[model samples]
Target: MRNFLVSSLILGSSLVALNTNAAGTDSTTFQVKITVNESCKFTNAQDVNFDAIDRSTGKQNTATGQLDITCTLGTPYKIALNGNGKMSNASNSGSTIAYNLFQDAQYSQAWDKSNTLANTGSGNSQALTVYAKLTGENNVEAGNYLDTVTATVTY
Candidate 1:
């Protein structure tokens, strides 16, 4: 009887150990990390130069400015554009100095309202994505092309 009991105890202990190890091995951990990395490469075809020219006036307006960004490879990014008239000595009136800013001439891609959510955000640097294919074309005009592009930011 003593011998049988001892053997049964050993077998039971061995079985419990095997089950515990198996369970532990099959168990897995799922983790997600949200870290935003911004790699910006802005390329504005219009090289703006604020030249205060001397004309018939004291304050000569010499602002032919443009802004663009080219950044293509990263996690999916969101894009957005700054408001118009942000450059005209911003004041209480909430207006712009430039004439055609924040107009339709600034966008390269126009996604549907639902589809556009991917490239829009409420943050600085405003999500300007770098497309892998378009970046290689080098088709960006050499001269001063007036456009107001929204930035893209991806994860």
Candidate 2:
């Protein structure tokens, strides 16, 4: 009976040791991360159309148009116009009408490739206005004059 009791006590002590070691824990750490890139695009662009002008009136013709742009937040961009600053006659290529594009209503700042409009993006669609004026000339041909202006956004 004494030997049996000692054996039982040793088994109980081994079980307790195993339970204590099982309760302890160890761990290692890892990382989570991401990367974002800058981007920009043109949402919309409207044509600038001037009202029919009667050359005999001898007055400058004016018009306004809009451009919409969307870009990543806090991105800096430049808007430029790529036109020759002249409207060629569709019927007669030799004849041309002189015109100019402005960034303001008062036609003070020129909006062209050389003179670009700089702005920052708000992560939403932004509307920009293009102001244009046709120089009044007494000898302009009596017909429909047209011009194509391309708007470019540089980030």
Candidate 3:
């Protein structure tokens, strides 16, 4: 009887030790995180072409162009135009014609470095129209007059 009791106590202790090791559990937590930065880019910029302007007509020459931009969703952005606001003659650099850029067809809301167009991004391409006009007084020597305007986007 004494040997059987000793054997039972040892077996019970072994089983308890096994259960304590198997049933015990511990846990910890780690972090999962990410950050999205505001971003913007110009997808396309079309040239503002004033084709065959007849200076003799004594009328304001107008042209329309476009700029396509894509940006992060819900990001606010501003677009500014930077240029000399004049189209220089290729043959004669001294001979130039002054022009104006506007945000509207009515020649209102001048678009320049100071005055910018503001909007919210939709994570897709957005089209913005650029209106350009040359007054009728630009009677200078005009043989392939050209100008470059940079569009800067700020988010």
Candidate 4:
């Protein structure tokens, strides 16, 4: 009877060892990623104020204004201006004035959609100067005139 009991205990211990050795391990792998979208924005608000005008001069008067722009590094961009030269006076609905915007002080490159001035970003703020001139004789009238143009940045 003792021998049989010992033999049974040995068999149970061997079975437990076999089951422990039979157990296995496993692992899994996954992927990670991110997408960085390009972005840009105007850093400042600007207005091309052509102060008081002398309509009697019969000559073009000029004014200057600047805006700051910031964009992602290595981003290519162009600034375009769109507006009609005919500016209307608030007090006199019938009164209007003509003007033009340019990309240089010489008033050569018209800031029109067709021009599409091109530039690149260096991860820093850049100043863009807008030149404006009231061409031809200020033949509109002797009243205050105003015009607004939208400055668009394309990347």
Q: Specify the highest-lDDT model's number.
A: 3
Across 1-155, the per-residue lDDT of candidate 2 in tens digits comes to 99999999999999999999889788999999887677789999888998877767777889999999998899999999989788888898667787899999999999999999999999999999999998646366777777888899899
Cα lDDT for residue 96, candidate 3: 80
Off by over 4 Å in 3: 1-23
Model 1: weakest 10-residue lDDT segment is: 131-140
Ranking by TM-score: 3, 2, 4, 1
> lDDT at 117 for candidate 2?
92
User: Which ranking of candidates, highest lDDT first?
Assistant: 3, 2, 4, 1
Residue lDDT tens for model 1, 42-63: 4543533444322333342333
> What's the residue-level lDDT of 7 in candidate 2?
98
Q: After superposition, how far is residue 72 of candidate 2 from its true place, in Å?
A: 1.1
Question: 3 or 4, which is superior by TM-score?
Answer: 3
lDDT of each: 0.38, 0.87, 0.89, 0.82
Candidate 1 TM-score versus the reference: 0.23
- Per-residue accuracy of model 4 over 81-104 as CA lDDT, tens digit each: 888776788788678777888888
Best of the two (1, 2) by TM-score? 2
Per-residue error for 64 in candidate 1, Å, reads: 8.2
Q: Provide the lowest-lDDT 10-residue window in model 4.
A: 135-144
